[model samples]
Target chain A: MTPPDRRRRALLLAGLSVAGLPLAAWALKPVRERPRLIIVGGGFGGAACARQLRYLMPAADITLVEPRAQFFTGPSTNAALASVCAEGDIVRGPAALEALGIRWIREAATALDPVARRLRLASGTVLDADRVVLSPGVAMRWDRIAGLDATTSERMPHAWLGDAQVSRLRERIESLRDGATIAISAPANPYRCPPGPYERASLLAWRLSARRLKRCKILLLDAKDDFTKRALFQVGWDTLYPGMVEWVPHAKGGEVLEVDARRNTLRLQNGSRLRVDLASVVPPQRAADIAVAGDLVDESGWCPVNPASFESTRHAGIHVIGDACIAQPMPKSAFSANSQAKLVALAIAAQFAGGPAPVPRLVNTCYSLLAPDYGISVGGLYGVVSDRLSTLNDGMSPLGAARELRAREAAYAHEWYEQITRDTFG
Target chain B: MHRLAVLALACLLLATPTTRAQDSLSLSCAVCHGARNAPSTVPSFYGMSTAQIESALRDFRSGAREGTAMPRLAKAMSDDEIRALAYEFGAPVR
Candidate 1:
């Protein structure tokens, strides 16, 4: 056994013996065995939770169930679209979890019985745990958008979920002609990364401008009238891209009602239709399928979690974090997921120890790149007030900040990306 | 080195249950300043006197010091909480 594991075992044995528990309690009771923690999903939320749990509760048996061999972070994928960084830069092997003594089960979770504390894997293996953490970031709602399905994704890549789709979208942008038009459809609220579509549009405009494709323009169709950091993005687009971008809000023929992938056309809710050379459709999203299958989600398509402990209100002993849970005032970003993961880790430890979980004051900072060096950010500190997630104090980058401040924010964004990845994956 | 790393990591990871006034404020301060995993790069709250940390927080809460997030976080913290955090994080790492 590793040194840490040995120390944990010693501590457990000592505690059991010092309590003077009966033989039945120590030997006969199955629940009294080392508390097993099954973490579903290995994205930022799952991976970071696993590592933190292993660190804080060494005696707990932690197993992470993730289907993917590597995690591709969507936080900085816009930089990849602009060719500022290679697609590989955002992808990382999740094998580092083993260093923290976390057992990784490379399989998809098919079923979860919260009442029985049982989880079933795709390979037909059933594992029981004392507590389970559901961190399956998000499941793309393909059914919400008509004429859009997995097959349609080949032509009109959403590129919002994984690395492969992101590369496909980049390829579509690269092959565009000088006069070719590209359109991006932004989804409704409560999706992963609120400002992501705008960031992608800004970066694509930068690339098209750099290539001197003056006639090629980007058409951003939004499902919402206003977006997170809309003013900041508008200022950046006007200053940097000039007349190369057009944004249409939902009230003005922006909400996409249907997509004719065969003709590369979009039918908006406002009775408008347009054909484009390339289309990036970000559909409405919901919690992962496993969360839904376990009956953990509500009619809102998101899981309601107690902001203090992130415990699913629908079920007990199942804590949901990251994008899967509704942590309002906390955007579904990598930083928020990491912050929430830490909170979940501690709450679980306190739960098993029969101690009260302290209220967490979480923070989230989201950065968007206007150029390679020019960036803007919006951030806030979140805490629980009267059972709802409340923003203590929040602000965004001044729209009129100097170029140097934007550059510094851009650098800080990169630094944050590096730090969060290390904290999560390593 | 390992012990220091563990302490830093612990500061970041697990939130100590707040039994006293200072403990609660220290946990809040750890949110942005540093923690077991996402340690702060701004400045070390460790190895400082309670007086020093308290002065900084008071200045931030009152806008005596120019800042952004700190001022708001400090504003939410009571004077007693700030004094408690000062003493909590002030002790030198063993």
Candidate 2:
């Protein structure tokens, strides 16, 4: 071909290519849209999910919707109950997510549209996606604690995972006379932080016994017969401050029937009531607001999810994890939430983008306070089987360890706390 | 022929990106420690107990340990990832 004619032809071809760009882009779009995975409630579960999703699927469109600007984990707040501090000590907001290029917002998820696959936020922002991972932590089940609503909670602190309520409770504890009794009522199962009430009681009793010579008492009213870490907690309680802490299980006169915050009195199911100085009723909880409104929960008021992927059974493309979902053989600790979140994130990445998820292994470690020097812990390595999680009982706790072993485990517990915080936060 | 060749190149460019790669790291303790997995001279993955591994990790993170690759490497990992690697290799039974 002639040089001039060829140059002219090349220019024409380039213009045609530029003109076809929009049409070609439109044609390349998938018939069914690329599934957008939306993670709700930016706690351990949501954060872990987003982090792993970013790592696994860099190109997949991922958006995380959490109401809170920052996250203060329950891990550190378990210690805040002893000291005179507020949420400021425990609350480290969601800067971790921003580092991973995950988008976050400070608004609650008000509603969910499962069929339409869109999550509606409190501020009227609609997040439409293919899969929604809901880990709204837990919401208070008002029925468990009578006469205690949001306003009543301010006076009678639940402080399930925050620092303020714990600080307020500590202040109440300190101002009271030595002979006065401080009451801690543990609401039903599935509260935000299970090991919290015992840790608080232990820390308070540690101070009370040291300062007041066994004058102050912590009457722990538990709804369940047993707790996360029982024998170790009891042993530490007995060794540190015997008779300073008295636990009343639900079988006893411990089931909290009613509460009058103004009077500082508690009524039990057995028709006996007592007046106390400090009242903390950790109420029963549900799956935030969105999970319930979305009809994702079973009759038990908790979301049932596939244990492996944490995918909600109620809704396809929706994965419920962390405290909101019913994770049996596992307490709703931050460690459990973070572990499950990573699994769900990987599962979704594989489902939508055809990658293999690593064989899922999970871990849960919870540390409780016994004079802070004597820490009590319960943990286990877990594996998913038959689509259910089974705790590897072999390597968890050396069953019925000696006192020295327990104390050493306690030290490891402290180390575990600091290490896990850095792991999740940084 | 040139137009046909350019069209062929465009099709190849549009293929899906499906290559998953993970950063793999391994320690060869033979020279410094000893070889053949036992590492009798220094320390092996199996030689260190759980408590020992946990202590090393804690010290590494805390800057308490003497300068070494194990301490330095342990410091860089998150508890999640540390436990993960520990879960993979720690408590190795001889």
Candidate 3:
């Protein structure tokens, strides 16, 4: 037999005890039971958690529920807009996950029943498992903005979730006239990616510049007065796109109160209106609808989870991670989801093995590319202290960094994108 | 008498804000390096001595050790915090 077959045979033998096997051989085998781990929402958090559990608990059955067959990472989607990376390059499918022995349920999770330890799917399938991990990410609060809903989203795509929206947004930007003006409206705090809007603006400006649409302008209307890596992004805008990009803060009538898709006009909170050729409205967000339906969220609209294991504080036998849960001091980003999910998987594995769960310290790094070779980042380490997740150390890219330093950081960003995607998907 | 005095000193040190901050920082290092059995591409601190971890962290903080995300991360921490991490990672596993 081949080496792999031999190894598999050995593992199978190791897992089962012969009826009349030697006592020593029986003692050498693992005595603990392998529990079923069902992970809902196969994005960064769910996918990465499934991958890690496959490695940590080889005997355990792992299942991942994601509605979509493919996932496009938010990290490199901005680069996709600039045509630096193709839409397919940012996409992840179930092939790598299935290869890891993870059962993929291509259906949206409709309800989670903690009492019964089962999840109800929209397809009328019920999944029962020893432990359930929820990483349902966020849901757009379309009601927060006037004239914004599922149907209208097609006209003015947020392009935040999947490749389809991103592709539509890219096509719209690519078709802009030379003197056209585009507006990107940023959502309030506690959004999925803090620097996402700024990065989108930068990439759009880069595309316009490359097309030599000097008369084309990009307007960034932010709900907050300041943003993540504000200084670095501002400097990059001045140096690279220069006069092509403009930022209006909340105090300066930048908070979008209403959007008129037909006329492509946005009314601000300060009672001001601006008519633009294109508008990308990123509305307010909250925990995924499933979390709320599962009664896992509190008044804050995010799930409260134990920091050590990311187990839901509201429901036993269920753990929450990624953007759906409160991992304060850790931004709601892909890297944070991947890191937090791995720790949750480890803790779950420990529970099944009849051992104490390892207290994990989690790390997160969020990088934004201002130009093809100009990048900025913010990173930190977080740990559970006295049962709360607390920040230990954090830092951002230095303000006014040298051009060479920015260039190196940009290269590191691409490398990080490759490594993190592999880590999560594989 | 001397043992009591040493115990008192240790308790007092642990209660200090500076020492507490260092403890927090040291625990954060474990996020990336603490898992021994898990599959990871990053380096581990499981079996290293305090001096070895300290020397390496100092180099990273000062840009002596280049590449990856360590230098910038270390620069965010202080010398005392780095030493604290060394002690935590270097502690003999019970």
Candidate 4:
């Protein structure tokens, strides 16, 4: 054990003694046994919760179950697609979490028994925890989009999740001829990253402009009539990429019914065909398979949790955060996940101390880049009202702001990404 | 045992007398401002006095100061909450 661990254990023992617990009774229990906290999924929510739990309860046996050795953040994947930054810039390794004594389990959790507080790994090893945090993120619902399954996704990459799919889309964008048509089909509401499709379109426009591909047409086919940051993105598009991009809302037959990857065509709900050189279709999503298998999800296909502690209402000891849970009024963004993770950490700490979880004040801020140097942002504060999360105060970047202010916000956007990733992963 | 007792006493002395609400509220700030050692374009509140934090927040809340996100965030905080945040984060770093 490290010296800090020794010190913390001593403090804990001393506190227990002060509470009039007999030394003999303390000795009866295993001296080395500490609180076991198992966090499944090592994305923003899981990783951030692990780091915070380490700070709050230094001696807890915390194991993070993640299959990947390295994590790539979704925030900047659009920039990577636009070639604004290299793919390596967004990659983070688990060394920092490891240095804090967090056990990194490089394996997938095959099953979860919330009632028993046990998890079964793909390797057939069962681990027990006092409390479990499931931040499994989202799993794409391939069945929602016809002809768009795992195999077809190879041809029409979503590139929504931050992975090699981003590279795939980037390659397709790079290989496009001057007059090639690109179709990007966005999903309906309650999806991860509300402003992501718009940001993706903006960044793609920026890239095409840089490559001097003036005649290339970019079609933004949306399932929803409106999107987050619509005004800001439309203004940015009009000013930056006029006549280069077209956005078709659902009312205007923008909802895609089927995608024929072989023909490079999307059949719209209105029975119109859109033949394009490349197609990026983002399908509807639900909680990951593990959460569904654990019976944590409600009828909405997302887990419902007590707003104060994020404890699953369906199951007692398991807390769900991130995209896997239904946290309305809070978009499923990285910032929201990070905020939820911290609150869950505090809730768990309070539980360990035999106190009720404190009422949490959650905050989220998301910045979208229209260009490398132009940005817009939306931020909100949330608190529980009548057993539901409600927005307290929120605002977005002022429309028609001066160019200089937008530039400043753009710089701050990069800074926010850097600090948030460092805080969570470290 | 004597050394352990001394350590315990020191730990108590070092612990700040802040409520759970304040601790939870201050955590949101770290998402942007970050820990003391982490470099950021956003200003760190490490060495700021309680008065300074209070003043800045009030100014931002009242539109006397200009910021991208802080103004909106400050508007959400009550005066009591602001004072609590100031007290929580205003401590000098050693």
Best by TM-score, which number? 4
Candidate 1 lDDT over A195-237, as tens digits, reads 9999999989889888889798899999899999899899898
In candidate 1, list every pair of residues with a backbone clash: B9-B36, B11-B36, B12-B35, B12-B36
Prediction 4 global C-alpha lDDT = 0.87
**Model 3: what TM-score?**
0.81
Candidate 1 has an lDDT of 0.81
Winning model by DockQ? 4
Residue by residue across A124-177, what tens digits does model 4's lDDT show?
999988889999988898888789998898899988777678789989988988
- DockQ versus reference, model 3: 0.09
Native-referenced DockQ of model 1: 0.15
By DockQ, the candidates rank as 4, 1, 3, 2
Q: RMSD to the native, candidate 2? A: 11.3
Q: List the residue pairs that clash in candidate 4.
A: none
Best candidate, lDDT:
4
Q: What lDDT does candidate 3 reach at residue A26?
A: 34
Error of 2 at A350 (Å): 1.3
What's the TM for model 4?
Answer: 0.90
Put down candidate 2 lDDT per residue, A1-426, tens digits, no spaces: 235644665665567688874334333232233456788877777776777778777776678786666655677565666662454656666667777777777778888987667888888888887678888877778776777777787778877755467667656666767787888888777677788888878878876766664777789998889887677678778877888899999888688888888898889876789898778777777777788888889888889987777878878778898988988777888877877777777677666553455556555656565765665556555666677877644122334556665565556555555444444554
Q: In what order do the candidates fall by TM-score, top score first?
A: 4, 1, 3, 2
Superposed by TM-score, candidate 3 places the C-alpha of residue A389 at a distance from the truth, in angstroms, of: 1.1
| Model 4 misplaced stretches (Cα beyond 4 Å) | A1-33, B1-22, B91-94
Clashes of each: 4, 6, 0, 0
Model 1 misses residue A276 by how many Å? 0.8
TM-score of chain B for predicted candidate 2: 0.48
Give the TM-score (vs. native) of candidate 1: 0.85
lDDT of 4 at A388: 94
